[model samples]
Target: MGLPGTIPPAQGPARPALAVVDVQPHLQQPATDRGPGRLHLSAEGASRAAGGSGGGEAVKVILLRDVPTLGRAGTLVEVKEGYARNYLLPRGLAREATAGAIRARDVMRQAEEQRRARVQREAEQLAQGLSALILEMRARAGAEGRLFGAVTAQQVADALRQRGFPVDKKQVELEHPIRVEGFHRVAVRLPTGRLVQVTVNVVGQR
Candidate 1:
């Protein structure tokens, strides 16, 4: 029965009960079901997010000259592609490691090795000559043995040069300043990593 101006509820077959199909744990849909294509896309996206596509293949270069914080001449090193192209390649400090370039670099490396060996031999000879040398210096001193002024590395190098030894001030290593007038041992580091000890005889000036 329907009242006036009121619609009667339309009647039809009741909705069928939802079938609770017991799905096994393995058969159940995973919470995150990424398909093979999606996984591939995700992996590529991850790689891009990490860096660039070319990040995997860094540029290999041979240094033509010494680069601070990088390497010395004739050194083969890997660097970023952008850095290689922008700075090293443009400045002639490095070249790409191609077949021809590698061959040329090997030749240069051999020549550099020979040059280094020659230099090392010269340094060893110099060190051996300097080992038996003694230097004498005259400085003003007070009643005690202490001098009025300290002897410097430059003074020692100058003395060595006056005696026909090609020595630089930087190569002379003094642990402390020479203030007293006496015999002191000075260490000179040669280019070949040999340490030569020389005796300096210091006397008071009259």
Candidate 2:
């Protein structure tokens, strides 16, 4: 029926639909090109916590020497629950690389480099002074002219102090005691590959 002015009634309810296209570049990249293999994780997800059956966390290891658990510096290695908890984490050798941790690492690395440089310079100065002096040791000897005890690192340090060198006992590396000695080459580890050859003259005591 026609009226003067009128509106029509609603026909049906409206429903919403969602359309999705996978466009994550990180996800599109291959696993091998992404992380330290074995498990496939995107670079973005690698740093964060995992979502697998066994929840594993990422760790950053700084290797001073050749440590077993901590592979090397700048290496992101995954470790099991016990190994990281029992050993690595407690030793101040490694830490979980959260966003904050990564930033802190950069700062620490810079500070460490500066400290290393200062130590190297100090070692160089010590090396230069060590080269100019000769070490003398007086000890009781047998009839064959062999020393009763030996000229050891302590003896070397003592003599060095007497001669005004004042080197630490630890800096001297003696494989064996200087029993039969004339002039021996002692390796003093100095900075920047600088080495000093100090001559030790052992005289027989009365």
Quick one: best TM-score, which candidate? 1
**Residue 56 displacement in candidate 2 (angstroms):** 17
Could you estimate the TM-score for every candidate?
Answer: 0.53, 0.45
Instruction: State the C-alpha lDDT per candidate.
Output: 0.75, 0.60
Score candidate 2 by TM-score against the native: 0.45
Separate clash counts for every candidate: 0, 0
**Candidate 2 root-mean-square deviation in Å:** 14.7
- lDDT of predicted model 1: 0.75
Give a tens-digit lDDT track for model 1, residues 1-206. 88999999999999999999943212123246653211122333323422344433577888877665566777888766765675567768788888898999888779988999999989887887788887889999888888999889989989998998888999999877799999999998888777899899899874
Superposed Cα deviation of residue 21, candidate 2 (Å): 21
For each of the candidates, the C-alpha root-mean-square deviation to the true structure, in angstroms, is 14.9, 14.7
What is candidate 2's lDDT per residue for 1-206, written digit by digit as tens? 54668776667988778878843222234455543322233444433322222334534444322333235554455654443454445745456656776677678788989999998888777787787656667788887888788888877877777776647677677778899746776766554556577777788764
lDDT (C-alpha) at residue 72 in model 1: 76
Candidate 1 — which residues are off by over 4 angstroms?
1-99
Following a full C-alpha superposition, what root-mean-square deviation does model 1 have from the true structure? 14.9
